[model samples]
Target: MEFGIFMPNSRNGYIMAEAAPQYDPTHKHLSDIVKAGEDNGFSFALTMSSFRGHGGSTQFWEGSLESMTTMAALAKDTTFMKLIGSVQLLLVHPALAARGAMTLQDISEGRFGLNLVPGGWHPGELESLGVWPGYDYNEYRWEYATEYAQVLTELWRDGVTNFQGKHFQYDDLQLGPLPEGGRVPIVAAGASDDAIKFCAQYADYNFRLAWGGIDALNDIMTKFNAAMEDAKRVVKPYVALGVILADSDREAEEKLQRYVDTADLEAIEYMYTGAVTDTAKGGTSEILASMDQKGAMQMSTDFLVGSPSSIAEQLDEWADLDVAGYMLVLDDYVPDIKRMGAEVFPKMKNFDQTKASVA
Candidate 1:
């Protein structure tokens, strides 16, 4: 198993709490964190795209660096660690995304990954920007994504495309200087049946968030595997984890409890409400499950809050799931990157053999 750092391109990182490390994002700070990850054994860097923030005193995600541009810039900063950027389908056109992928891959010297996002989990974000589809589009998430993927592949493979689909159309559009060799590896996320099938067909890696417990995670893995079996395709799986490192498990718990006690309910409510808005499977609605069971402010069981040994023990279980990589999200990135390097990773089971290379 390898590791990746989920760049805190968003304000305040992943945790939505006033008490969480509140500060403005900076390129210098972000660079320092991923550089530390490169020094460790992290294999990749990922940045998410966010258009709006949940309303609250903290203004969660109100300000964020654009994912594509951010990754392009980070490409210049890192020697290893593949970098991926997200493209929100509703906000970005397929042809444009295809070209952008080519540019980033070249700029990164072939260390670029593309993440396709089927937008609509946060309707308000799209609506605010006037890009929200004028019609109902959530139910057709995977279908729309399939077309988007087709467009991208055609453009990348042939350097031009003449296609017509329900959601998009291209009139023999041309994009020059295709990416070297072929298409960049793609990453996508979703837990719904549609999502699973789509990943099996198109994405190279599936980004997932699993909760409920060991049994539920097993169920999800079963379903995902079944989909891949039906499609006769193999797509790697990865997870996003919120990490809190401390000298002891008790210390970590104390820190977590403090944040939970002061969690920005107003902002959390917005996320919860949006997550529950659609009945679609494996979307943000999945977040609702963990919020209901573990507490809204904190993340799923994937949230690793403990000392190096304790975190390693927890990770050992996940590594058994055959996860391709673990995307680490930290409250404070730079310092935590250093501490994780010195303590936690050295003790992790499946990842111990990965210490030699940046990837």
Candidate 2:
């Protein structure tokens, strides 16, 4: 399987605990992480787009770099490895998004992709910018996203677009120079059935939270594959996993306990309450409601924490489910990255370093 680092564009990375690595979301730090991934054998690096922060003592995700601009700078700095940046469809017009994507594609020499998010969960983020579609727009956000994707794809492939829809309109619009490959890959997360269908139809890959274990993951993949078959197309499946490694299993367990002990309960509560209240109709709200305190603190994903050998064994077990790859969420950016590259990567059964080098 392939591997990629979930670049920490936000403060405190993915972990919400105060004990986690506290660092500024600076360009130099991000660049260092990207370079480490390239030097290692990673296939890509993805950054999430966040317009606002979840408030608490830790100030989780309070400060973040804009995804597209950050990826553009990384594209100029790196020679290989795809750079995936996120965009919230509600915030930017599709035409402007397409033009920015085209520029990024050129900058990366066709090594750029997009992670599209249909905004609704964090309404305040868009509302502050005067772009939120209001309360009634929650249930139909995906429908709007479909139109948004259609406009973007048309502009990229046909170089001109003339269309009108309930959500967006374009009249004889043209964009160029077109992306080098004639198309840029799209990635998206699908928590509900309709969202899964949308990904099968439009996205090159489907990203899901690694909340459930192997059996749960298998069920998700089965549904995703069925959706693809129904659509007469195939889309790869990826999972987001947090990693915390140590010299031994005991040490790793201790560290995990510390993360939980100092957990940002207020921050976690805010996130959970917000999801259930603002996104009551969405599938993710159900998932959030089902999570326990620890699960919520870990962002409802499996934390692959153990010695190198144990982590490798867990990864091998996960790969057996035929996952396309993993987007690793690290606790500490630089040190953990170097250790993963030097230790854990060599033990992975599905990763071929030679093939990655040639690719």
Candidate 3:
């Protein structure tokens, strides 16, 4: 199985200050994060894009770096590990996003991938960018993304594509000298019906947040399998995002509780209050509780926590669960990355390689 790190471009803490805090926009922590991943044998580092911060009374607003630019910067900073630019398909036209993806691929010597997000933020961001065409929200976003995927595929593989859709229209478009693979792997994320269906239809990999337990993941896998069969397409694989670090169960619990204690509850509350479109309904306490129950509490079964041997064994269990890969989130980027690489990775290397043979 492949592994990667999820880098947050937006604010990622539990507590929010009254005024927006100025973070290290240059992403000085990034080089170390990438180096740690590469040395530890990770396949890639995924960077996300968010245009604005979720502002609430208690929320902390922090500026974000653009996704494509950040990927290119990280590409120059690291050698072996691939980089993924998580782009919100609804924010920009497909042709433009494709060019951005292709440019990164060229700069990184074909070490670039795409994670297509359907968007889950306030409508004002799109309106400010002059990208919002209508207010159907979820449906409009998915339709735009569906066409976006079509355009990207056509431009990359077919040289030029002409297409029209409800939200976007384009004449002949071409993205040249595509990635060395001819097609860049595109992953899509969303749990809603439209988003899930889109991934089943076209994505090379589907991304999901670790919500419940084995049963929850199994339920999603079963649904995805059925959807692919109905569409007469084969589902590729699904990768999950989770926090996975701790040398012992006790240590894991302590670390998780620390995060919760320090967590910007205000930001989460804002997210539930429509600042984040997708997870708006759930209350902050409910969201936090769910994360805890879903393994975020004290390292659920989904996490690869504990000693190297134990973590490796945990990875094996996940492999059997049809989790082709994982994108790990770390509170302290450098230290956890170093320990994971120096201690945890060697064991995982063996575990990952032996899977195909076993299957």
Candidate 4:
């Protein structure tokens, strides 16, 4: 399996807590993380496109960098690592997104990727930006996003699309100069069942959280593989994991406890509330509702905590699940990234950190 950082372009880096290192995302910090990933043989990095935050003490995700623009700059700066920028079809029209994605593809010389996102994880986030179609949109967003991808793909591949579909109608619209290779790799989170269907049809890569243990993951993969079978196309899966490392398991557990002890309850509640706002079943939102206190507040599951070897063992267990790679979410990015590269990388079993392409 390959590796990637779920780059912390959002504020505070997914740990909703007052005690966690609370800070705004910066260009230098984001660049440093991707650069570290490159030096360490990480194949790709993805930044979420979040326009707003769930407000509470830590102001979770309140301050954010626009993903596409940030990645365009990264495309120019980095030489090899694949940079996947996100676009919410509701916010940025596919015709327009085609332009931005095409530019980044040219800039990165074919190392750029595009990720389709919902209007926002929360409806209010898009509402605040004057783009929330409606709350009922959550139900049909899967279909809408599929159509959106169709248009974007057509425009990028053929340079013009007269495609007309339920949500979008592109009449002789054109975009140029086309992306290198005449296509851009697509990524998306296959959260709900419908979302998985969309992935089978459209995305080249799909991300699923490693929340449910192996059995649950196997079930998801079964469903995904079945859909792929029907669609006659394959979408490689990547699992996202949370990391908290130390010299020993005992120390790692203690640190995790401390973060839990000081967990930002109000912000956590806001996160939980917004997550469940979607009626879609079997997604991260539902997982949040089912979690007990620590599970919910700890943010994500499939944690790799302990010494580097211990973390490697955990990764091996996950690697057996057979994903395209793993996208790591580090509790502390800079130091954790360095430790992961220098220490843990060599310990993992059957993992490949080599890049096959650049420039």
Candidate 2 structure quality by residue, lDDT tens digits, 208-275: 78877889888878777887888988788778888889999999989988888888888887777666
Consecutive 10-residue window with the lowest summed lDDT within model 3? 292-301
State TM-scores per candidate. 0.95, 0.96, 0.80, 0.95
Q: Any idea what lDDT model 1 has?
A: 0.81
For model 1, residues 121-200, the per-residue Cα lDDT tens digits are 67788888898774367778789999999999988999888989997887989888999887878999878888888898
Candidate 3 clashing pairs, residues 3+ apart or interchain = 14-263, 14-264, 15-263, 15-264, 292-297
Worst ten-residue run, lDDT, model 1?
292-301
Off-target runs (Cα >4 Å) in candidate 2 are 278-282
The alpha-carbon lDDT assigned to residue 310 of candidate 2 equals 89
TM-score of 2: 0.96
**Given candidate 3, what's the lDDT at residue 248?**
78
lDDT (Cα) of model 2: 0.82
Candidate 3 stretches greater than 4 Å from native: 13-25, 55-61, 121-124, 127-130, 133-135, 177-182, 229-235, 275-310, 347-350, 353-359
What lDDT score is found at residue 16 in candidate 2?
A: 75
lDDT of 4 by residue, 1-359 (tens): 77888887888887776767888999999988888777766778899888788777878888899899999888866888888899887889788888998888888888888988875346767888899887788788888988888888898889999998888886899988888777888888856888888888888999878876777787788888888889999788878888889989999988888878878787777767767777778777677767665676567566667988898888888778757778888888888888887888788776665541332
lDDT of 3 by residue, 240-266 (tens): 545446777677656555544554555
Judge candidate 2 at residue 113 and give its lDDT.
86
Model 4 quality (TM-score):
0.95
RMSD of 3: 4.9
